[model samples]
Target chain A: MTSHPPAGTPSGIVLEHVTKRFGRTEVLTDISAVLPPGRIYGLLGANGVGKTTLMSLVCNHTFRSGGTVLIDGEDPAENPVVLGRTCFIREDQPYNDAFKVRDVLSAVSWFYPDWDAALAERLADRFHLPHRTTCKKLSRGQRSALAIVISLASRAAYTFLDEPYLGLDPSARGIFYDELLLAYSEHPRTIVMSTHLIDEAAGLLEEVLVLHEGRIVLRADADEARTSAFVARGLDSAVTALVGHREVLSERRLGSILSVTVRGARTADDESRARAANIALEAASLQELVAAIGIGGIGGVDTESFTTQRTSR
Target chain B: MTYARRSLRLYLANRSYVTLIPGGILVIMLAMSLVIGVAIGMATEFPLSAQIQEGMRENNGGAVYSIPGFLISLGALAVNRNFAMALAFGSTRRHFWLGTLMGFGLTSGATAASAVVLLALEKATNHWFFGVYAFDVAALGKGDYVLTFASVFVLAVLSLALGALFGTAYRAFGTKGALLTGLAAAVLVVAVTLLSASNKEIVGSWLGALGVWAAVVVAAIAAAISIAGSYAANRLARL
Candidate 1:
């Protein structure tokens, strides 16, 4: 039931039936997904989903209620050797008040043996954080910039960005995206970024993991997932006949007409079938697919994020 | 160049540490205390050695330590209550503790240096260097309060170690933890104060300050355990 990793590289992340409970509430239940090395994977889900929990679990920031996490084929929990290769930049990072911005960089430099100080300095210039601004005085946007700068510059093989742009303005976000892409291209690694702005970040992702109610509802190539699900717009009867014995992700009715999101192939047969029925066929975007699954009750209010198990390729 | 860059980055980014807001209250309080401490010593015409001796008497045979126990409680609260401040660019728990200790040591050194300078100046002026605390004994033996000196040294070390341990715990546990720890410390301080007279006599009279050192020894051990456990817990749960 699991996908194996490609040859010649370590699986960046592997989670098998991982479960996390916060007191009486089960935040993540039996989650199992693999994220292979050298891919930009987008972890998309709505609020209150276990996206952060799963990411935290993989990064060894939080203890797992159940299941095993293997980073570079080693347990990440309290294991310095493994953790050194991973950078989990939290949504709200804490810094000591007595420290200056430069001093902060100095300390983190020693944590990772392979840290790129030059890249960090270059990114620091890009972010334009005033050299003298104490962390407390920084604007919300600046704080987000600091987080982005560190995650990208740290050059950790396994990097997790938990809502890296929560407070960034569009221009600043664009800078973040550009820096991230440029860095990734130069030094490819496994990047699992959990975000709400799916459409805005659509192009940056190579794969998408859609979570619904603590379970993955969709995991495929960004193009494949879209290609797999097609929207067929036609009369109610025609749409009904076309979707026969296939998965209907979502359906909408206006007067006697219908817009049905049916799980089908982006292949020739599926297209010809729609054309033959005289129904307009269009490929679904990641956002549309996510919305359809989330709102269609495929998963309840507390849907978890798409967790990844790493493969070499 | 690397060190320069790191320190610069840390200083620029560490806004949270800015809470050492050079405010009126803190400034006035520190200034007033210094003034009072110096002024009282001058007016009374007491010997500095005599004052250290009084602390020795106060503890019976306990150590002559001068670390305001209140500071330990303050450190615990400071690190944890303002964690977001700590989490900023420059402040991590480890570095914060290190910097704070350095700052404290420098201040204490300055105090000692000033005392020495003033003593030299006094001798030049043909006056004895006055001390604030005078070690007086109604019935305690001469030569020195052996237990008192031992007690002060032991308590200073104990309090410093406890400060680091509790400070870390307070940070990991946050506001509620800090408050709880602070309250417990205050309660203990009061209890210790209440029992000081009799406890000092018992330890000083025969056992000497060794018994008090034993108590500090036990406390230091407990603090070590707490600190280690908290660090492990943070690693296990922090995301």
Candidate 2:
């Protein structure tokens, strides 16, 4: 009803050469990145790409093989103060199936000093979880909803959602996204969400951190990341004339219209030349940029001058 | 919530495994005991005298073998598996053993009570042991009744202790732990049998038999205390 006050401005989370290994198999290797806080963070990576492992180290769920991770400031391992301030909803959170929803709610309430019981119940109702139904009987989606409820209700200073919507349908996901944004607007806590559905969730994330094979391939503002890359389409000769020697991420020819994702921003001259050549330039979505970076971010990229790169839409 | 309370709750909610499995085995055990009792009757031609003779010495004391075997099987992983439920509630390992024992203890009490009642009724009429008068046990004057009842109490207690011993030691041991438990049980059986055979009148005096039983009961209780206490300290420390 009232005008929303600006969300609390939180700085960034820094990971310094953080590496984690489980026995002999190395899950993550030399992962270092600085993620600005306050804004929603989308940790984009394929499955087994070390997104979950990195998040675990960040939350101190498991020990790291090497390196350090800082949450705003200070280490998180065994520090009750830090752990209490964090809410990490594991994919398959261990809970007794015989326990009714209400029991789990009450138990978790005690774990978090700032836990909001009212918020938890409200979210439970929103997700249609019957208080009488024990956790074992609850559907997988219901389990995830319960997890979402706990994480949001905890109001933990740092919240990590690791693929929170794996089995959720689009409509259910829409509800989750809406509730998440609403909650974030009301209480601005640091949120790091890892997901495989990059395109579907593109609109919800404010920033992006792309991890490829246990390393941060790209990190920047979601919009800026999209804007910084574009696909210019026109006659191959005409488009080639505009683009000389810039880094070309990828190019695909659909009949005569040539579309190529090029790195670097579009200059004024390049825009005019594209307009003169009657070419169309479309801004790359976060999904496209991620796909391009994920495929071959820094290595094996073809280099060409990109002058006609401009958003036509 | 306190760790104990949380563990109790977790134990209550755990359903990945069913308690019914061990419970069903318990029913089968009781039936087996009765069936074996009948087979003893038929094979011995239902002659009361031969049956009595066979009861005291058949198969290295069949009734005695039943006592330890039942306790070991009941107290082993069949009971320990229930502890896994406690982990869901974030229960410490110490509480896990306690809760599991408490659960199996209740079941053990019911079965033992029924068995004792049946045995008492049988002993009232059938005087199997020579010179051991049934009325003497009932007299309660020379403390013979106390001695016998106490033996029953000690047996029940020691059997349960043996069970809890296996359960606690096997709690962290997964499936492999069960195999180790079986091997240990077999070895204990052999040792007890050999010792009893070497020393014929194992029951020197009724009071002495009760004393040995009492000692075993006390030792079992002490071991349970030590194991559970150590588990608490270790859990507080870490994995």
Q: Can you tell me which runs of candidate 2 are displaced by over 4 Å?
A: A1-14, A22-25, A34-39, A70-74, A78-81, A92-107, A130-140, A299-313, B1-8, B12-239
Cα lDDT, all candidates: 0.60, 0.61
Lowest lDDT 10-mer window, candidate 1 chain B?
A: B133-142
Q: Report the C-alpha lDDT of model 1 over A1-313, residue by residue, as the tens digit.
A: 5554542247778778889998888888777777778999888887777887788777655678998788767776645456657776777676655555675566567545567888888877877877677766777877788778778877888888888888888988898899899999998988989988888888899988877667666687887777767788888888787777766777889977889776656567767887988888888777777877777756332223322221111
DockQ of each: 0.22, 0.09
Give me the TM-scores for chain A across all models, comma-separated.
0.83, 0.82
Query: What shift in Å separates residue A289 of candidate 1 from its native position after superposition?
Result: 1.5
Interface Cα RMSD, each model: 6.8, 6.2
User: Can you give the lDDT of residue B97 in candidate 2?
Assistant: 52
Q: Which tens-of-lDDT digit does each residue in B1-239 have in candidate 1?
A: 33223323333333323223212222333344335546655665444346543553354221122243543453344434333332222223334343444433333333333333333443354332343222222211222344333323334334444554466555456557656766866786687667766588764554354444455454445545544543442332231
Q: Which tens-of-lDDT digit does each residue in B1-239 have in candidate 2? A: 24344433333443322233333443454456445555665665443355454433333222233455655555553334334333322233444555554544444444444444434544664633231222222211122444434443344445555655555544435446546755865786688668767775753453376653544454455445534533443233211
Off by over 4 Å in 1: A1-9, A97-103, A234-237, A253-257, A266-278, A299-313, B1-239
Residue B3 CA displacement from its true place in model 2, Å:
6.3
Q: Please name the candidate that would achieve the greatest DockQ relative to the true structure.
A: 1
